[model samples]
Target chain A: MSPKGKTRIRRFSPVQRLFHVLLMLSFLTQGATGLSRMYIETSWGKGLASVFGGYESCLTIHKYVGIFMICWFLIHGLYLFFKIDWRQFPRSLFGPDSLLPRFEDLGQAIQHVAWMLGIDRLLRLDRWGFLKKLDDFLLRITRLPPLNRVSYLKEFDGLLSVITKPPRFDRWGYWEKFDYWAVFWGIPLLGVTGLIMAFPLFSTRFIPGWGLNVVFWVHRIESILAMCHVFIIHFFIAHLRRHSFPMDRAMFEGSVDLAAARHEKPAWIARLEQTGKLESQLVAEATPGLRALFYIFGYAAIAVGAFLLIGGLVNSPSITW
Target chain B: MKEAVTRVRLVYIGGAVGLLIGLAVILTVPVRLARGQEEVTSKIYRYRERVATGYYEGYEVSPRRARAILETPGIKRGLFPYGSSSAMVRIRARLPDSHKGLKFYYRNTCIECHPEQARNIHSVRAGITCRQCHGPEPIPAINHYYSAMNTIRRHSYVCAKCHEGATAAFASFYVHEPPAASLETRESFPALFYTYWGMLLLLVGTLAFFIPHSVMVGLRELSEHLSFSVPHTLMVGLRDVFKKLVFFMSHSFLAGFRKFSQKLSFFKPQNFLAGYRKLFKKKEAFKNETDNAP
Candidate 1:
């Protein structure tokens, strides 16, 4: 067979792409509804509330949207569990060689900050170097690392080595791990507080007279934190980063251009190239059942959207000055 | 793979059907569960009875009927007399003495039971007796003592007729200005009860925010034991708790502002006033110098 010299950028499976689209829409709706409620006294708040019907209707939609968000979180978690290769999964989490920051990563971060401030030129540390050095140093000093590392660190120097080495599918990158933990912690804090606010009866059972007030406080503070995190960290990494400006398609298209991947995730590119066997393995790993599940969820989401739209229309309050 | 596709299609159809049904049910269920006509009438009658009893107990009276009367289109204008005189009082005074006969006659004569109250009535204006407000004929079926007690209870309406203002009835009756000893005896009991209830709601709501979840659950359960007849008391407690939680959460953001202010007294009123005064003096001085200059 003739060697195909062109680098083939693998696209996201149809299911994964659909899931990403739905997830983004759900988050956007939630953010709009939540922000509207938070600033209910303002003109923007009134306009947003009117879009949902009225103040009370906006609140009702906010509650249901919250429930929807939680369900999405659960589905996403299950997808990670069922579809993602378990061997590849843990490496993303503990793989210091990827994007998981170490002590040296802090220096790189500081250097980048300085470059932004025009104090110094941007540093060109290797993709895995700073993070890998930090992970190794932390693991050596701590003795006890993550559960994934406890089993694999004996054979491998650290998660960095495993991720950077050949023969493993590089589809799941280090950035995915950072995003995972960020969401994992953020969702629970917001979810529990949100549930309390939404379900007053349930909250009152435990919270006493001040249950609503307490829920309100926690909900508002957590919301502010989540918004700040999304605006600063998530925005910076996803769009505002030097090379990723305009957009990064890896999150939505679930694929990166070879040149961009080489520049941003060089270790991942090197590992994939060294292991000629990795491509076939990844292709084989894609299951029809996973695609089927995505279709099911997509239909479910459409049904939910239609129901909400109908309910909103029928019960919409008459607006008066 | 084909089988999976078929399964997905089935699930999708099922989800759509289920959602439609759910939406239909949610929209209609509240209307269906609403009380029927007979039930609604009985409930309204019961509520009226409760309000009548509450009036005798000296609880704050609702002006629902009066409000309804006021809201009726053209009614207020129609009721208003062409002359500038107070129509309400004139109409009441002009009613025939024969029509003043009480529907529910009282057995107890006011003079027999509340001799002091009778004396006070005479002292204010001779011939102006309890019967003026309580009606001429007393209830022959009920106890005379109960009738006299009812008269004293209903006297609050007379007081309210003159002294009405925003929460002024409760405030004046309970927390009297230039305090009246005669009024004090009658007012203090209701005042104490109202104060206790208001504080209880506020305190319970506040406490619910800090305590463990189980403790809140216990408080909710405990509310059932607190009330005698109505489940409303428990609901009120729960509602207050929810309000408190919301208040606590919302005000938490203000804690940042509080901390900031504590660390540095930015825009303190005293400091602001001082700066304003200094600026005013400087401006005055400049104006004086300019005036003196050629």
Candidate 2:
């Protein structure tokens, strides 16, 4: 069969797919319940609290769901460690296969922003009005590093570029790497501080001064960052991207449609075919039932998440009590 | 590439705008104002003057209330033992005074709104016992925090709310002169007004703006790229620090048993020599027994 045909390309395996599904459910639950607890004074919060059987039970749900998510991550990490050969582990910082990020990505990001701001127009130089030219000049001046480019991240152009780019991934893009690793950063920060808040009296007994109080704020602040980053930013990128609108079922079905695989991970696909490992990389298509399940859950989550964020923002979610 | 970047640029523009808006809001808006902050410095000065002049003399304890308060055990045997700061303040207010003594007493959060007053009170009263300074009279008042009748804090009735029972638990401590006495004479405390505003800006700036993006991202980048990690290092260090703290706190009584425990060393030369000598004697005895048997 020609590789151009609609051959299913295995993306996430069964374990990985299960992990993703479980993670989605648990994370969504945790985010919802946690926010409700914080903003318990709001009407939605009051409704949610009652729906979850009041404040204490809502708290219980958030805690256990968080623990479950952590466990799922640990399982996924351990599986990857044991299942992959140590030599084949993704280690390079920047390459065709690596997510370590490359200078090219930095350049792509800068180019992308320039195009967005219409600075990259070919014929705009002579047509430039005074203010437009001033704007261009200002942008250029602000773009310069404070010092003679002694640092890769100086003026954080690299970081800004990285932040701006959606994970229009081939192999793994910058944002994909961030998505993969951010949990590693967020989990401990969230978990320990969360646990501290979870068992405040016990923690206060052992920890001194305003330690538990600090933990309380840290937990709230970090959780808000994590939750917002996931619900708003990651949602837009992963599910609502131009190419993957409505939803991305790549994670749920454990495979991407052949064209998607070719578009996004073209190099991976080509390498697999060249090495005669394409068959090994192929997987059965998601059944109608599974597809239905994916959509049902995915769209439901999207709706709930959207509702929570939009309503919370507009209403200024708060707890009076 | 241009199209891809244009799309990317849209995303960037959106995020940047969001960040800027959050920053602007955080910087421009103050998160909180002191409870009763007003532009009436003269009112505060007038109130302080009334406090200094000693508005009314209601220290005389009646036999009836003294008996009642004495039986309560928690109430101290002193002036106003049977009543709270609110009651005494109300009494002072009702007293015939040319000043607004009653209005000041019933007024909500004069000191509460004054960050300068709050800060001064905190510093001056840090290690001092509240009872020693305010005298162990009425056990302050059980202040209801929410929905005050007139003020933000029910405890705004008097200084005794914080100071009265603060030192009751401690047996040996000297009370510094009340902060108002020394602090009222100085004019520099109002400089703390700016400090309060600065704090509001900082809190909003960090939590609402800076921490939301810059600090969070900086921390993330630092953790991933840089070898230094806040969580990794803080957790391990905290655990060790806790263990050491617990050990010392638990062993405080055992200090008498080993007066120089901190200086005592298990790696002493005498101890090592004793063990070495014992081993040497046992080896010699074993060798002689083996030779005899052969």
**TM-score of structure candidate 2:** 0.48
TM-score per model over all chains: 0.37, 0.48
Candidate 1 local lDDT, B50-152, one digit each (tens): 2333232323332111110112222234555445555533333334232234443255455665454543312232235555444444222111223322322
Poorest 10 consecutive residues by lDDT, candidate 1 chain A: A117-126
Off by over 4 Å in 2: A1-6, A88-108, A111-169, A317-321, B1-294
Backbone clashes in model 1: 22
For residue B221, give model 2's deviation from the true position in Å. 29
Taking the tens digit of each residue's C-alpha lDDT, what string does model 1 give over A168-236? Answer: 223444335445565677677678878865654334333322333334445554554444444434544
The superposed Cα distance between candidate 2 and the true structure at residue A127, in angstroms, equals 15
Interface RMSD of 1: 24.7
Among all windows of 10 consecutive residues in model 1 chain B, the one with the lowest summed lDDT is: B34-43
- Give lDDT: candidate 1, residue A287: 45
